[model samples]
Target: MDHVNISVANNEEKGANVDFDYSQRAQWLRAAVLGANDGLVSVASLMMGVGAVKQDVKAMFLIGFAGLVAGACSMAIGEFVSVYSQLDIEVAQMKRDHITNHDQELAEKENLPSPFQAALASALAFSLGAIVPLLAAMFIDSYKVRLAVILAAVSIALVVFGAVGAVLGGSSRVKSCVRVLVGGWLAMAITFGLTKLIGSSGLQM
Candidate 1:
């Protein structure tokens, strides 16, 4: 089969075709960064929270290690689910547009020329979104906070991130902020609660 290259340019006139590379490397990078971030944040929080209740260095060390492992796994799974969901939505939207445009194309095949391009756009946006939190984790020292104030601050940061993400994605910023912040708080709350419960049990053990 002979291949004919077509250009989809911003201008009305036809232009030379450009080749591009598509890879899963972006998703992996996002996951790695977020995983490390979660490790820093959660372990740091756990150590701090536990330290508040007691000044036992050995206990704090143990709790920190546990938190690091648990948090990293949690982050990886969460990132995978989120990235996959975003990918799914992008695919579904593109599929829908293609289907809608298919009939339009049949009617005017010559005029409907630009192929659907939203999938790549959404993926790139999501990848960048994941990276920000990761960077924050790298910069913020996670070992110092020993109070609920720390939790509150991180929650606010998450809300800001969600708002930015929503804005970038052309979504409702308020809704996104609430949704993301609430989810982060819920996680923090659950972990904090579990720490109290399990820490007591550890003492007994």
Candidate 2:
């Protein structure tokens, strides 16, 4: 009877471990979904706003197409550079850990390996997570109002999502969200302002 109980306990532990692995995988999916959602929401909103101002369907379509193309390329480049920098930081951190471990061994200090491994995993996870949204947002339809809306929405959402990520990683959620939101809006404002400026120079048809 004792053996049976022990066997059952071990099986439960194994099941729990598997469950954890599955849950961890879900984080990647969350990132992907958020990316797509961002693209759709922002672009849609932008399209609606522009459509309100300019009833010329052709102009709106061109503007949206241009925005989508520009946003996707910018996102990709931004993500690549951002992730590359993160990778560098992670490498530096790992190197520091290695040196610390070596020093500890020399001085007969003791610590567990688990902490170092955990840190490494976290850094990699963050870097990879940053890329998913950019890629997903690149799918905005070209030459369509929907494309414009999607690109704008995704851009904003990605910024917000990044803030949420910072919070999840134990940072101040309000601060992170506010900072990202402000920066994102500033960018959108600049884009719209430039578009309007260019549009205004033309004779009112």
Question: Could you say which candidate leads in TM-score?
Answer: 2
- Write one digit per residue (lDDT tens) for candidate 1, span 1-205: 1232222333223222111111223444334334433443455456555655565556666676565545544554555566567656766765667656666546543322122222233333333333333333333434443244445556666666666555545569999778766766666567667767777776643
Candidate 2 error regions (>4 Å): 1-31, 99-205
Give one clash count per candidate, in the order shown. Answer: 0, 12
lDDT of each: 0.50, 0.50
Go through the candidates in order and give the C-alpha RMSD of each one to the true structure: 11.8, 10.6
What is the TM-score (0 to 1) of candidate 1? 0.41
| Candidate 1 ranges with C-alpha deviation above 4 Å | 1-145, 202-205
My TM-score estimates for the predictions, one after another, are: 0.41, 0.42
What C-alpha lDDT does candidate 1 achieve relative to the native structure?
A: 0.50
Per-residue alpha-carbon lDDT of candidate 2 for residues 70-189, written as tens digits (9 for 90 to 100): 545444454455545655675576666776566755443322222333333333433333333334333444435443554455566656666665644546777766665665566456
